[model samples]
Target: MRDGVRPPLRNHHEEAAEELGTTTKRDTINTALREVTARYRRLRALEEAREPAADGALDMDLLLDKRAYRPRGADSATDDHGTGADG
Candidate 1:
């Protein structure tokens, strides 16, 4: 009961997407992608840091996965348009 505050409701994604002229699925995908990518990076580092108990120590995959939507490295590609949209 504030001057302009409103009660919280469920499914805010739909309302936000409608206001932004987008689909809720797209937002969900974006959020999930970001979270997964971050988690993968963190997990990978953690796995690599753990010491092996015996002499069978090997490099851990660390569960790091390449991002599907990521662009190429700045040195690997050229950008004539000055915009990264091409990558």
Candidate 2:
């Protein structure tokens, strides 16, 4: 890993470290960076999905039909444990 000097952060390091289950500054920083990177990747994916195709026309039908992509048992009413009533 590359090492560089960073400005002193606010006093939340203790709280952040506790929340992230890390005891060292380096571990906490690494966990925080990974979370940020994952968040940005998810946002980028959503943005790309919203962009229109090269034809400038969006296929609203396929996008709106969520049932077509749902799993086989997704529509069944389940009990507290997620097993269907019949089970």
Candidate 3:
């Protein structure tokens, strides 16, 4: 690949190519195909395991409470601990 000729890896194929460290078109396409197939296999395994991993006593409403847990004066970007809200 030419220096300063590469564009931003906005698409999956480009991103996969970058991740695989391949410069050639054939290598990039092969890497992308491998990534997609690997992803599909992972998703299929998750789907197959879903039924066996189900918990009957799990409470979604209690576990997933939507109420904000910010302490007083935590409305600002950072808290007293100097950590941002996102942290």
lDDT (Cα atoms) of all candidates against the true structure: 0.61, 0.76, 0.70
Which scores greater on lDDT, model 2 or model 3?
2
Least accurate stretch of 10 residues (summed lDDT) in model 3?
A: 68-77
Count clashing residue pairs in model 1.
0
List RMSD in Å for every model shown. Answer: 12.2, 8.3, 11.5
* Candidate topping TM-score: 2
- Ranking the candidates on TM-score from highest down gives 2, 3, 1
Question: Which portions of model 3 miss their true places by more than 4 Å?
Answer: 1-16, 55-87
**Model 3 lDDT on a 0 to 1 scale:** 0.70
TM-score of each: 0.32, 0.51, 0.43
Clashing pairs in 1: none
* Model 2 TM-score on a 0 to 1 scale: 0.51
Q: What ordering of candidates by lDDT runs from best to worst?
A: 2, 3, 1
Query: lDDT tens string, model 2, 1-87?
Result: 127855456457877898999989999999999999999999998788777653457777776899767554544435434686566
lDDT of 3 by residue, 1-87 (tens): 459676655565667768889987789888778889999999999777665556545454655675544455555636656687657
> Comparing 1 and 3 by TM-score, which wins?
3
